[model samples]
Target: MWKLSVACAVLCSVSSVAHSQSNVLLYGIIDEGVQFNSNAGGNRQYYLASGELNGSRWGVRGSEDLGSGLKALFVLENGFDVNTGKLGQGGLEFGRRAYVGLSSGLGTVTLGRQYDSVVDFVGLLEAGDQWAGYLGAHPADNDNFNNTNRVNNAVKYTSRSLGGFTFGGMYSLGGIAGDTTRNQIWSFGAGYANGPLVLGAAYLNVRNPNVSFYGSGGTVAPTTGGVPGSNFGSSPVISGYASARTLQVIGAGAAYTFGASTFGALYSNTRFKGLGDASSGPVSARGISGSATLNNVEVNFKYQFTPALLVGAEYVYTKGSGPDGVGDVSYHQGALGIDYFLSKRTDIYAVAAFQKASGTDSSGKPAVASLSQITPSSTDRQTALRLAIRHKF
Candidate 1:
């Protein structure tokens, strides 16, 4: 009887320990708004929009203590459109994020669909993320500052901070039976934060971005007959060259804070090689394949008018040049935004954005001004205004 009693006590103690070490949490954010586009498909348009400032999302995150400073962790996040009550990320259930990993004193390694290193690190320093949100992102989010897509079959690793510096990398398997490089994608990034300054840089390389990212799924889809995701919605920014043999990008940004104000700048170089026909899906171009390069520069500033109010402004310049005979394009974009916190978990905001374009697109067609995920203007200029409310829980 004594021995049985001791065993029971031991089991109970173990159970208690396990229970204390395991935790799970549910969290989410909702954002909805009204927006007016000065020119959408050539006519002024006004409509209710969801996620104008930030996408609506909910997620579950948890961790289990394993012992010796190691733990098991998992996150499942979903994005949705509250206005339509439909899932984002092309209808996938956990389209936002779904990953499991192990964490230790050294760092962490995770597996499953996930964001690339660029979006994880350098993206935070961009004005689009800090001030104007999507409205201020580089044309078409060409550098992915808005995180338009997530990688599937991805493996990611992150290192612990060293003197306020952190670094990470990610790779997504192509998953093709015979070819390992087909549709593969890889990226690396590092960031530093000290005092009131923050800096970050990242690089990304993709094989067949059209099929790998634009098409139905990160999972390989037939190069032909695949429908691109909604990310291509109506924006004509980079769609002309949707079918590229390769896409490479390098980006860097820095932010500094003074008193109640912050200032930031960002730069990126994006390149596309072996372009395909702009009319057909993401396949090789019909005739002589060409290449294009884009350089983007941005600067922004934000000030806290009060503990509950903030205001910001930003400007971006983009230039694109293709091999001889492909034509050149340039864009000038500017934005302003204001936010007021109603409570710790709720806020209201307003923003205005404008853009002008001069150049030719990859299809040899004249370039027209277009905002990220918004409709394109029939002319070379476009303007937009939005008012929104956000709640977090």
Candidate 2:
């Protein structure tokens, strides 16, 4: 009896230890590049840039196993600018991501600053360093495929894969003292993956988007009628719509892989509804009233010639329309990329892009070519080239 009792106690102790466990990991990615822009502020420019293909970031992730098929997880990620050695995402300590949540057979529920459903389900299909490198973002990244914005004061729920399908949603409280609707944000999405095929769709809505989304970074110059002076940089793509009372975006994408190649396509509709709210930037000067909308379509291809070498190409078309007499605008852009992996965590790449624009812009002026990080072109055409190196750990 004594021997049996000791064995039982030993087994119980072992099971207890096995049932409770925890782990923490640190990881990061660094991408730096030299870029040449055909025109920025109307001048040819060459410079070193950081986070071209992937924003530089470091993060901590931890998880604890609970007794009952459940786990508690947390992630704190920080974004930084390799070139300036400064914080990215407007100096927020953990701008990239900061969330804690629980996971179970059902799914996950997390709270804190977080990426939206669109980023989780659709962004991967839009462009992956197969590669847009930041500069390749479709016409101002109007659809937010670039993850230019993150939700705050948010509660998110993500479901476990059922069959080949997964889905998630998020709601961010505006924190406005008296109003529950103003500045609120909500998003949802669904995705499917099976074999070589992957597909996704998502939608995002924000009230008083100018203050919540754009101003989410920090202080901003009030509407002077053009675009607001914010970290999004100055671009006519958002100029006239800076005062939008609400911003809505819906996007969908699909990708299929065959042999050594993959083909993908994406579509997004972005609208700035109820414009002229007098918040972010130059509002009256842009003459924007009512609503302004943008529709973008992109097709991309990627091919792997060897285990170490990959190439990609993409073409995008964007059309913009608005109220008042603001002329309609359209943009045509194309990109090519080559990436050579030195190892699983390090690689070198080159990406080139060209853009052409036509018609009047939101500022009530002729549209000019604008690349993601480049200045608006003086003419209607712009081109850019970048050579970069990326390391992950």
Candidate 3:
């Protein structure tokens, strides 16, 4: 009896220790809002919206100890529309993120669908992520500062911070049966933080932006005139060039902190090349083999008025050029935001933005202003307002 008792005690102790070495957690966030648009589809509109500030999402994350300063980690996150209770990301079960990886003192390597280095690094310093969210994104978010898409079949590596400096790189395989480069994407980014100053830079290149990064719609023959079902959706800014063969973006940002306030600025250059084939019969009435480019510069500031109240403002200037002989376009945007925290896990916020457009547009017509996907104004100016609440667990 005594020997049996001792064995049982030892077994229980081992079991408890093993259990403590692994952990799983479930978390979620809900964001709902009301938006008033100066014009929507050519009419003034007011609508209930989801994810005006941040996308609603639920996720499961887990980690298991592997001993010797190594561990295995995984995350599966899903996005949804709270108003309609429908899945986001084209109905993907875990469209936001799905990945498994190993982490150690050396660094971490992950595989599966994930964000690229650009979104991971420079995005954090932009007002689109730090404060105003989607409404503050550069026109069309052409530089991807808004995380408009995630890379599929990606392999990523992040280096452990060393003296306030860290870096990361990512690559997504096209996975085409015969062509390895059909939809390949690669990016790298680095950041440095010292005291109250932060800086970041990133570069991304996508071969066949429409078919590779956007989706598979552009796979149709070039004779189709344009890709179908592209991710560009209703945005008139860059949608017409969704059939571009390649897209490249470069981004850089910096921020400084002083007391309870922080100020930041960002710059990005996005280029779309190979719009169409010269012999493809005008390719939707535009010159073939044309290319487009957009340059954006933004400045923003945030202040913590109190422990529970915050304020932010931003201004952005954008210049975009259509294909050769297609003309040029420019935009100026201004935004203001405020947030009040009810608790550590919940908050209410409001954002207001105004934008104006000038010069010729992609269709060789005068550019009509728009904010992200709100709605293209019949004139050259647009305004939007949103009030939202967000809760996290």
Candidate 4:
């Protein structure tokens, strides 16, 4: 009896120790609101819209203490449309972010599906997290720096902070069996934040982006008949096409606080290359483009009206230039928002935004008619109003 009691005590003690060393937590946010857009156009006429303020999501995260200053962590988050109750990210159950990795005093590394460093670092600088996700993301988020949008067989690494500066990198495998060069991507970025100043820069290169865009279920439709701007070019085969696209983006933002108010500004530029078919056409149609450049500038002001009330306003301008013979377009956006805090983790907000476009279409005339057809129309001015309540735990 004594021996049996001792064994039982030992087992219980071991189990307790193990349990104390590990922990798992369940957390999530659900934000829903009513939105109205002035110009939705045609049969898609604007009505009540959901997920205008924030995406509705739930996630499970956990961590385990593995002895001396080292730990293992994981996060599995999902995004859904509350109105339709449908999953985001192409129907994947855990599409937002699903990754596991290790962390130590030096840095942290994660594997599985995860956001690239560019998106992780620079996305925060955008006004209202780039309100035009699929519809308005620059380059349609094909660069992966817009948000938690891209994830497929990826590995990411982030370094510890040193003097308020940190760096990160990520790579995604194309998952092509037996073929290594099909649709691979790699990115690197660094950020620095201290006091009232924050700055970040990043670069990403997608090899064989043509295959990846068409085959990997990107936003661009393959049946659209040739690229967006080319002159009646035939649709490129998904496999036979070869175009190496590279994206280089640089951004900087700074905010200064004075009493109960803060003022900020941001700027970014994106350049694209290797987008034309040289084998079958004139060199003018081939090679990198000087017109694919996009530039953005924004200014913002936020004031704390009271202990629990905050008001903010922002204005943004974006310009896109096609190739030499193509055309140039510009967009302007303005937004005003107010937030009332009910508690530390709960709040209600109201925001209004307007966007206008200006440029010429492919026919060399005013592109006003094609404004609604374009993703981020430089002509289709729109006004949106949203009221939402959010709770975070």
Candidate 5:
């Protein structure tokens, strides 16, 4: 009888412990606002949109304690347009992030679609999580660090912080049959935050990025005819070739807090390479970006008027250059916002931004085209304002 009682007690204890270690939580946010763009060109229009203060999303996250400082964790998040009730992220169901991984004292490794290391690190360094996202993001989000955009078919590893420092890396397989080298992308980055000081940097490279998708219905073929000094006549008809594109980015930022205010500055540079033809075929039109370079500089300040009220402002400048005979373009943007905390997990806010473009496109072409238009022949200035309420639960 004694032995049986002891066995029964042990079994009960095991079951209780297992139950305690498992958890599932549901959380989501809905943010919507009416935006008015001053220079919407053909028509200055007012429209409803999502993700004013943050990306509107819903997700389920869970973790199971495996005992001895280990756990299994997963997150499935989805982004949607509140106005249109449509899914974001290229129309995929879990466009924001969907991944599973194991975590321990050493670090965490996740698999599936996720943000690249550069984006994960440098993105946070930006003011207001890259200025409240898409509308405030850097031109083309060309440098992942500013946008934290997601990567597909990725395997990522993040190391535990040691003395306020952490590092991470990611590799995205092309997954293309018979041509493994096509569309492959990889990145690595590190960050350190101690007290009021933070610093970060990263590098990224992608093979054969499909630029045709930049505008229109994606039918335009990638072109090598743009290479400078190529014998191809003006506006040459050349199909895009299988070429590698590399982006090396270095960034640093610092912030200081005094009383209820915080101020900071950030700077970064990105360089493009491998644009030329490797086969020596007309030099493949590389380095048309003449003597000019791409540079971004920003200054920001945030003030907490009260425990529940916060205000922030930022200014950013971007410049792109093309080689001699090629034109150079520049962009200036300013943003102001205010947030009111209804509670720790919920808030209401308003944000406004204005941008002006004067310069050439990435190709160093003339500024006759506007960067904000995303399409050719559009104007060079845009303004947007948003008001939203958000909650996290």
Candidate 6:
């Protein structure tokens, strides 16, 4: 591990120098887990996993005071596989997040790869982003409530909190020459946080979503049935809708906290318009030539039995409809989890989840249960259990 030591030494040296000139902080999380899947390709499977509850990562952030009510700041975060020590988010250094921005009394503005407005406003309300983690992600992360997508070449703005209310917008420039409209994405969102109550809403639009959002995220598939842009293919939830000219999402979420208990509800709708690419585009199992849409609703509850212990349960329902007389598909899911904190910076957790599918899928075949972050099950039902530990600094 000499190489690792050398790397650490170099980082420490740089951090020390940077800290001398500005406010800088280094932080990270190490999360690892073991999981058991009742059905994976119709067979029981168990294995070691990473980022089951939270993606392991390290990051450095710094800010320099510029003037009255102004500051210059930047953040570089990297995701990695705790089990194999390999880079996450497709191997890019600082793949999880990298951005530089300025903050003022009015708000904050940043440029570079960053989250879209939808994620900032509504995603935080999901339990997956909290105690549930990736295993609790909605089917195929269909609505991106679990943060499966990120905007590249983006300029984002978030207004300062005004009486516990905030609003923001983000736009991603396609940067494709001679095609000003190609690969562009834009979104708007707003949120409110007041004692015991929290609410959020947003809408996002993407053109050539496969290339603008999916392809840019480091998911690779040199070729998938000759489709040029779409890289998502593990399940019909997205593959069935790929090749669409545009993708649109609208969602709202709300939560209420009283004492040591919290309750939340969320709704989202995703639509893919103008499906069916020329022979050069994504091919559908049933040769779908029209549009498709997916809708999701989730409700969850959590209670803190003690300052160090918490329990939660959630249920989700998803429905999909395809054009050209394609049969519809639906998924029902439930999850339960418990987390106990040994200390503020360390915690251990366990989660169990089950899902069932019905109707015809995008593949033009009977639908099979497909949980987010896992391969599709060979049968119509699947169950999973995981135990993990996380340490933060």
Number of the top-ranking candidate, with lDDT as the measure: 6
lDDT of 1 by residue, 142-198 (tens): 888778878888999999999999999999999989989888999999999999999
Q: lDDT (0-100) at residue 202 of candidate 3?
A: 96
Better of 4 and 6 by lDDT: 6
Can you tell me which runs of candidate 2 are displaced by over 4 Å? Answer: 1-20, 128-130, 218-232, 279-282
lDDT of 3: 0.84
List candidate 3 stretches off by more than 4 Å: 1-14, 216-229, 277-283
Q: By summed lDDT, which 10 consecutive residues of candidate 4 come out lowest?
A: 231-240
Q: Against the true structure, what is every candidate's RMSD?
A: 2.7, 4.0, 3.1, 5.5, 6.2, 6.3
Write the residue-wise lDDT of candidate 2 on 168-229 in tens digits.
99999999899999889999999999999999999999988777777675344454445454
lDDT (CA) per prediction: 0.84, 0.85, 0.84, 0.60, 0.64, 0.86
Evaluate model 6: give its lDDT: 0.86
Q: Against the true structure, what is each candidate's TM-score?
A: 0.93, 0.92, 0.92, 0.80, 0.80, 0.92
> Per-residue error at 392 for model 6, in Å?
0.7
Count residue pairs with overlapping backbones in model 1: 2
Task: Give candidate 4 regions above 4 Å deviation.
Answer: 42-46, 130-148, 177-181, 208-244, 277-291, 361-379
Query: Candidate 3, residues 160-193: lDDT per residue as tens digits?
Result: 9999999999999988899888789999999999
lDDT, candidate 4, 247-326, per-residue tens: 44566666667889877776777554553543211223234333255577778788888989988887767676655533
Candidate order by lDDT, decreasing, is 6, 2, 3, 1, 5, 4
Deviation from truth (RMSD, Å), model 5? 6.2
- Backbone clashes for every candidate come to 2, 8, 0, 5, 7, 0
Better of 1 and 4 by lDDT: 1
